[model samples]
Target: MGVLTGRTALVTGAGRGIGRGIAERLARDGARVAVHYGSREETAKETVAAIEEAGGSAFAIRARLGVPGDAETLWREFDRHADGLDILVNNAGIGTSRPFGEIDEEEYGRLFAVNVKAPHFITQLGAGRLRDGGRIVNISSGLARTAAMPQLMAYAMTKGALDVFTRDLAKVLGPRGITVNSVAPGIVDTDVNADWLRASEEAWQGAAAYSALGRVGTPADIGDVVAFLASPDGRWVTGHWLDATGGSLT
Candidate 1:
């Protein structure tokens, strides 16, 4: 139960959904988790409480990402609680389903800002604080590889960029024993997907049918995969993009 004993983890956007699931799982493994939220203070608190109730240790931190000085503010707050970092999960991001023609520069820019730039600068600024042998897990998406949803071209592009970031960052940090990898999930039954996924019986079943598993994924499905990558078992693996898509891409 304590695979990550004595370690510390920071999960961005962990107020709910996949972020919360990752935070809970890390804590369950005995890591003192820092649950970072942008504006969902209440949900952040709920995540902390849930972890604590499960006999795990966790605290909530807030930083509105995709803004100027966001990385600084996040680290500043993190420093107040921890001296160093053992794991960093860049899970904060926004999703869009607009087609190429319908999308504007502003929308595209915001997508890249939150999904791409935030993780880039977060790692850049916080690299020093990450201890040797630490782990960095970037939450990417299966859309990066397949064009199953043409409407998500911009969103998919952002994830593709993130996968590239993971590869290069792993090389840059490998000398220090840090492992960087991208965990790409296909579709999950999270609040973010609730609107469209649950719109109709057909929509729900269609999403489930995308995966060979023949069911909609849950947050825990992705969280468990990240847990493995974050653990010592993943030490030798770096600069790779893991498919957490339940064979959806296969």
Candidate 2:
């Protein structure tokens, strides 16, 4: 049996991308995963199907974030499937590629709403349901520390806030034996970056060069890191920001 047998995990935005990878990994490790998707219900089902096909347990839950009553709706949906939570991965987020000067009020608000507000409320509401020694992993970005792209200023700011939340929440939840941490990823080769990353060989090489490993990161890379944080082996690690950037900051 896997290390996470008898545990329950909830991975937000698991419909696709890094979230999908995390969900699959946790399921592989023997956790009953709740694949949370906003609007991509079909993709969420696909993730669950793959997990089940591999002899793992998983289910899909639909709840659109960044809107009214999102957290409540999400918990309501979650309650329908599971009774308690063991791991919570807040991986749902959106980015604005526009420059700082070009970003409008609505756009900025939307980014913060989805990236900041949603996770904050979701965790707050979920805390009671989470058992002692539960794990909370927030998916942050390396841009929160380094200004890789000026156009993503607002996006970086949201992640920065998330990092702070990770630190503070860890302290508050420590008494309960719950560990809260953030995992920051660099240039990952996911569908979100597929357009430019696959534009040309040079484009791909340029991105890869940013990492000391000289390779683009995959969804599995981030997923494995997150899985460690969710596992018992990571019990002692908390309130820290893990650089899963493949040494890009080096």
Q: TM-score: which candidate is best?
A: 2
In order of appearance, the predictions have TM-scores of: 0.98, 0.99
Clash pairs of candidate 2?
Answer: none
lDDT of 1 by residue, 42-161 (tens): 999999999999999998988999899999999999999999999999999997758988999888888999999999998998899999999999999999997667789999999999
What Cα-based lDDT does every candidate model obtain? 0.94, 0.95
Which digits, one per residue and each the tens of the lDDT, describe model 2 over residues 1-250? Answer: 9999999999999989899999999999999999999997789999999999999999999999999999999999999999999999999999554689999988888999999999999999999999999999999999998756888998999999999999999999999999999999999988899999999999999999999999999989999999999999999999999999999988
User: Per-prediction RMSD in angstroms?
Assistant: 0.9, 0.7
Residue pairs clashing in model 1 are: none
Which one is best on lDDT? 2
**Any runs in candidate 1 off by more than 4 Å, and if so which?**
none
- Alpha-carbon lDDT of model 2: 0.95
